[model samples]
Target: MKKFKIGYRTIKTAVGACIALLIAEYFDLHYFSSAAILTILCIQPTKKKSLNAIYTRIVASLIGMLYAFLALELVGYNPIVLGIMLLVFIPTLVSFKFTDGFISSVVIIMHIYNEANFTVSLLLNELALMAIGFGTALAVNMYMGDLQKDLDQYLKNIEELYRSIFSEIVKYLRNGDTSWDGKEIIEAANLLNKAKSIAFKDVENHLTRKENQFYLYFDMREKQLEIIERVLPKITTLPVMVQQAELVADFMEELANNVHSGNTAKKFRSKLEEVKEEFATMPLPENHEKFLAMASLYQFIEEMDKYLVIKQTFRGIRR
Candidate 1:
């Protein structure tokens, strides 16, 4: 059997619901348990999402009250009237793009329908319920678990994967080693996606923050990884190791050693330019096989240059 553990969201939802119930009961509001339901619905993983849920629920509940009052007063309080009201009310909410609030609104509509009365006092009571429930949810959801430590670990793991990948490429270029299973490439790709997801969640948790530097950093690495994947076959399939391979291998080793969050792409790009210049002075390939190998090596170098250029264009994450 799979093990289950309660997460922070679960804890927050429980605490918020209990608080909503206590406040509602203290006020002696009729149908006070509805406040707990509202709290449960409003609690979300991110503060921004929770706030949006609160807004949608409040607007839709108010609209539902209006619909209930009109249908009950004009058509009389009957089951058919309730059904017809829902038919029109659901479509109206959908048209207004308030679908998220449908369930909570239905709860409010039922309360008014059960009372069979729509008075100013009833409206005030429902408003109070909304305030207590959504307010409690908002208060509880304000404490988002800090993700910075996890993001930093992800960054470190991704950089280590890059180092391993570069080291493997260096081995292949230097002595035609094919022992490596290229697991680091797959691992890095998966880790980058996971990191980006977490970083995006972190962004959502901060209502006023429009951008996340860690997210941008992972995006940059993902682009570089794409280039690396595209060039891997060319590097591994080189027909023979040429003198230029040694130069490329040296550059790869240096890059592997310096795999970090810092902006060192410019320095590497300068070194790459020197390597390209030296390539121009090297003797022509002796045969077709050597020519093919040299061609592949040149393509690999160009791709590496692109990889560095991607980092160069990125506004790196601050430490």
Candidate 2:
């Protein structure tokens, strides 16, 4: 049954359609199915999108009915008239920026064709169907709820990957442990990409545009991951400067534990800076290999600085 489970949106649409049918039947509308059809179409995942769908549907229905009425009154109902009506109506709706309603508008055209006469009673029936369909969708979506929990879960997943990646880096620096396959780095990047998409959808769900912190958080992680990749290879080539490497490993360990903490980022940056200064004071390398090692360590410092700066900047951003 788990494999056959349906989504909440599916359930909501079905329930809304049934409610719409009951309302139309109670009102004695001849084409009660029209209300149900509209209900199914109008149920959207987000309240904002649902509202927009309702608005466009109603406008398109009005355009459809108006065009149908004019065409029927002047030229009479026939296949030729219906063809001409669609040609003109589709373009007119496009010009008026009501294209979102065009598909739903076809149902209105069908109703006009079936009735074959444009009368006040028939017009009332169309309006009643619109009200019932749109109203049911509205009521169903009012409790569709927010995606804050889902966003939080994504954040947690991404942070776990971050922790794994940093710990791997720490292990390599401390003992030159080459057991890590770098799979976590790729996994983290992929997860961050997924999280960014969901976070943007969350942003769109709100009527008022707001800064999506989750999106920014993942964006920062992605930037840090890129720096990590570059740092990994450079650190591997450095001669074992046991004391310096231990300092780096300790800082990385602290960073992995507090991946989500903004305050810890500043402390890590300060410690890394001290390590950079200490590296500079060490006696000049006696050969090319030592010089290369010194250069690589400096490069690693610069990358680590950039990584910490990304998080710090993200935390300070207002939007």
Candidate 3:
């Protein structure tokens, strides 16, 4: 059944056109044959290129017919004159890579004239051929059902990846390690890379189906992802500086631990005060106290990560 459906459409169209042509022959209806040919060949569901093909075929057919009519009028109904006209026009059509049906229609129009006279019957034949061809293709496409489900899924995945990267960054920062010490940076980079790969493949494979306008967002995100990745290595330096500050904070924590354990409180309090003052006075990136508040966030995250680490560790926390 699946195989039948798969091959049925093309065979059905050919048979339909065959029957029309045979009927025209039996009834001595030449115009019906032309229209049957036109219909079967002109209509197809090629999506992006369908309208373009139809317009070009229509134009080419008209040119060929017009030239034939002009030749017939100027030179009269001579066989030699018709032969010479075909020689001149056929190459002109072939030179431009027009479809077989388009060029054949011209030849057919040149030769498909009635034995009786110029009549409405001839025009109807050509028109009917085109209608059948076009209608058959459209029917086949509709029967195949929807092919756009993949496009929707692709868009959804892209949006989800974008939001996931942002949310993960927030979670990593909450650890107070601005240096991006954990898995956050790597995970974001990997996911972003996957996102780009998916987008590129989707666009490349289905440019006809994809929207050109939506591509702007894809390009923008790609560039931003590259910049963020480049900045990541620099963030590593920030953790080193924060780790130094964390050492003092760890010492203060230890002192508090010692004092709680009944060690001499006076010396411990004195040292704790000194360490706290030094930590508070740590120079900003720009060496300005006012700007200490403006210190690099990456550095602060690392410093805080270490501070929290020791605090947690002293209080018997695993991480």
The number of the candidate with the highest lDDT is 1
lDDT of each: 0.92, 0.82, 0.48
Higher-scoring candidate on TM-score, 1 or 2 = 1
The full ranking of all candidates by TM-score, starting with the best, is 1, 2, 3
lDDT of 1 by residue, 42-156 (tens): 9999989999999999899999989999998678888999999999999999999999999999888888888888889999999999899889998999999999999999999
My TM-score estimates for the predictions, one after another, are 0.98, 0.91, 0.42
The per-prediction CA RMSD against the true structure, in angstroms, equals: 0.9, 2.6, 15.8
lDDT, model 3: 0.48
lDDT of 2 by residue, 149-183 (tens): 88788878878888988898788877788888888
Q: Where in model 1 is the C-alpha error above 4 Å?
A: none
Q: Model 1 reaches what TM-score against the true structure?
A: 0.98
Superior by TM-score: candidate 2 or candidate 3? 2
